[model samples]
Target chain A: MTALINLVYLISVSLFIVGLQRLSSPKTASSGNLIAGLGMGLGVLIALFAPMESGDDNYLIIIGALVLGSGIGLVVAVKVLMTKMPEMVSLFNGLGGACALLISIAELLNFHDSGTFGLAPYLTTLLALLIGSIAFTGSLVAYGKLSGNIKDSWKLPMANMINIILLLTLIAASIYQLQALDTMDLVYFIMILSLVYGITFVLNVGGADMPVIISILNALTGVSAALAGIIYDNMIMLMGGILVGSSGAILTILMCQAMNRSLLNVLAGGFGGGVSSAVQVGDQTVKEVNIMDASIILRYSTNVVFVPGYGMAVAQAQKICKELEDMLEELEVNVRYAIHPVAGRMPGHMNVLLAEADVDYSKLLDLEDANKFLNDTDLTIVVGANDVVNPSALDDPGSPIYGMPILEILKGKHVIVLKRGMSSGYSGIENPLFFHEKTSMLFGDAKKSLNSLLDELKTIV
Target chain B: MHLIIEILTDHLTILFALIMAIFLGFELISKVPTVLHTPLMSGSNAISGVVIIGAIILVRSSGSEDYISLFLGILAILLGTINVVGGHAVTNRMLQMFRKK
Candidate 1:
């Protein structure tokens, strides 16, 4: 039975590696998921019966944990929409960090060997405690911003200076506590301050930089885990900790580079401002087209491309998009969707939205593939998308979003934009995609505009 | 009975980490794009190699343990080695697919 348990543990770890590997590839990711899950289940089974633990009452604890955890997990799984996934991920990370912090604290109190509880253990624990607390609280604040539990973005006069002060204070406190190991109270007080600082610091950050922030928090969680493992002298914990810590650090660096910002810039709350508001386009009123007028333009077009963004998600217009696609196809016009990498709030936000409305995945084209098609497209129907299609990413070098590649919808023969108003996008930029010579603004709710367009399409056909 | 409880308490963190890793791993891989295929796969593969370090530490520390535990730890190290090597190889292959500036 002991041999069997060891074999199971080995197999479980192997599956975990394979699952993570498979996840990187699109083709075999789902299978990788199943394999990883199976590994976890097998590991639990081995642990349950392994000779290392000798409790007859184990069945009760095991069943109780599974029931409680699975039940809560099921509820969260079923309730959360794809749109809320980033926030959900933050919450999940917070829980993990919280666990690491709690375990470390517990281990400190139960420290058996006085000699081993010297400088190294104390320092690692202090570092872990500080980082983990920050991760926990910072993730919560991030969740708040993403979930709209608080104002999405705010600015402070000297936010950077304050963040630096708080960080220095936390570090100083950690150093003080390292030498004063006998004084648990001071250690805890510093931990509290650091944790609070972490919360406030993260709260000051806007929603746009959340992806990288979450990755950073994840790395913190790993560091905390490693520290806890060292304190407890646990091999599995150390392995898991090192893995999470290094990978998370690398991921944070990668994410920071991808966004063209430094880790310091990210920490200093210097990264994102809102989308640019529409500047003075004096005396030029945006031309609005009713359904019939819009269809008249659509009727003659040889090729049509639809662009969907966050507004499309808010209005749940994906179904209507497919409806419009089918209607346009009936008129012998080719229709395609131009998807930008960062089109919606999170990565793949647009794809998930489209998939929910049962849009054919094949019609969704990546930015590179779709960029070539935009030149040949006769009509570009933009549905509630803004900054992604902004022309400033190209023509205006002075613009904040200048370097980011945008879909060249202006190249199309005719462009129709669906918007609620001239309100800025998440990046706070007013798009010139709204002001193109061939563009006609159809201002309303995305779904309503599409419904009206559907009626108009019937009349034109 | 007490010994069993001790074991469970000691290893609780490891157990939870495994569960969380599995869950998060599944959720993430399900949605990766074809463009990110190489990096994502290789990253996860490399991550798996953490098991090797864990095995080494366990084997080195458990000086008083029976031969069975030592054997199992060695097995873990071997498995972890496979992950590190294979994961790095795959990642390098994937990186080659991208056009370099």
Candidate 2:
């Protein structure tokens, strides 16, 4: 029995490694998932069959739990939309943390003698309990913020200061509990306080900061798992936990860099709803053309660049955009799709949408790669995109998104913007690119505008 | 020589597990150039054979008291298999869509 259990553990670990590796790339990610699922199966098999000393004949209890948890997981995995993935990920991480906390608490309660518990077990148990509790509540808050159940902006002022005070209190309580070895009640009280504090701290943070927070919370859950493994003296759990912890930390840091925000600022709840209202339009002489005229210019241009944004997704114009590109290509005009990192609500949102439309992978260039070509291009068609092409980022210091790298689409010989109306993006900043001399606003749905452009192109051909 | 083999055998289980992890990890992260994400995601869904084998091995070897474990393992294996098959079918459909003239 022990041998089989050990074997299963070994197999599960291997699957987990493969799963993580596959996740790095779009191509093999599915394969990696399958391998990971295999590993999880192995782990569950070992955990269930491997004889525990617990004399409770609670086989029915365990079976019931397995059924309930698996059923819930199955429903979530099958029914959840891709748009809600980040929130789902946060919820999943919370479940992991909650499971870790429950198991650790059970272990602590079952401890017959406090004297038998060494420094290693005690320290690990305490750390796991603290981190798991934080992750569980933090993730729930993130889910709420992302799903719009909670307000997207700052709910309370001086929230940071309050969080700091609560943290200090939790720390002092933990220290006292550690010192006062006899008071189990004190430890329990400290744990409960810290759990509430964790939830409130996350609740105060806005949705804009969730990407980084989610990654950090995931890492915390991993740490909890590792601590749980230490408590159980399980090598498989230890390795798996470490892998998740390290990788999650790396991912969190990367996300922070992508947004050009410091990890410290993200943790301190620096992001909120109210955007800076300082408009800096210093008489940079501009001209605006309507949709029909913009199409005429695009038809005659030798080279054209299509820039897509979050608005494209809202309009579901990916297919029409592709058709326009095809039409442009037919006209013997060079065409390419310029994508910005933060173009959509979530990372890879642009990529997924474009992929769905079967856009040529080679033609799709990142912000840095595409920025150089935009200046020389005869026509830069800004389709349902705003903030990414906003020139304010480059010129105006007072702009909220100042110094953030953006595709300089305004520099192109001719620019046409496909937008329904003058609406602010997620950052709630005005795009001066709309008023630029070389730019034109084609006011309508992106799909309808692009379809019209395609028709115009066909007639010209 | 005997000692070396004994040491290898003792840790062989762990070694094999790590190797599988390494392979899967490598395979997972190799992003299908953004263009391939849809097909790849769908394709990977069908690779449930590994889970099935693991579950079968576990249940067959598990003792009487391990009934709960066996049941859970079997259930996991079934779900994993379904995910793999369904994922691949979706990938195929997605790819076929692109091929439409």
Candidate 2 on A250-282: residue-level lDDT in tens? 556555665667877777665444666467555
- Candidate 1 chain A has its poorest 10 consecutive residues by lDDT at A53-62
Tens-place lDDT per residue, model 1, A276-374, is 433545456677788888888888888889998777877878888988888888888888899876565444557656755656667788777788999
lDDT of 2: 0.62
How large is the i-RMS for each model, in angstroms? 13.4, 8.9
In Å, residue A307's CA in model 1 sits off its true spot by 2.4
Which RMSD does model 1 reach against the true structure? Answer: 10.2
Model 1 CAPRI quality? incorrect
Q: Where in model 1 is the C-alpha error above 4 Å?
A: A1-7, A46-63, A112-118, A154-157, A226-259, A270-284, B1-101
**Candidate 2 wrong stretches, greater than 4 Å:** A1-4, A112-115, A204-206, A271-279, A282-288, A300-304, A314-335, A357-360, A373-376, A381-386, A397-400, A444-461, B1-101
Model 1, range B10-93, lDDT digits (tens) per residue?
A: 557665665565455445444456344324423442443333333343344443333443444444444333334333333333
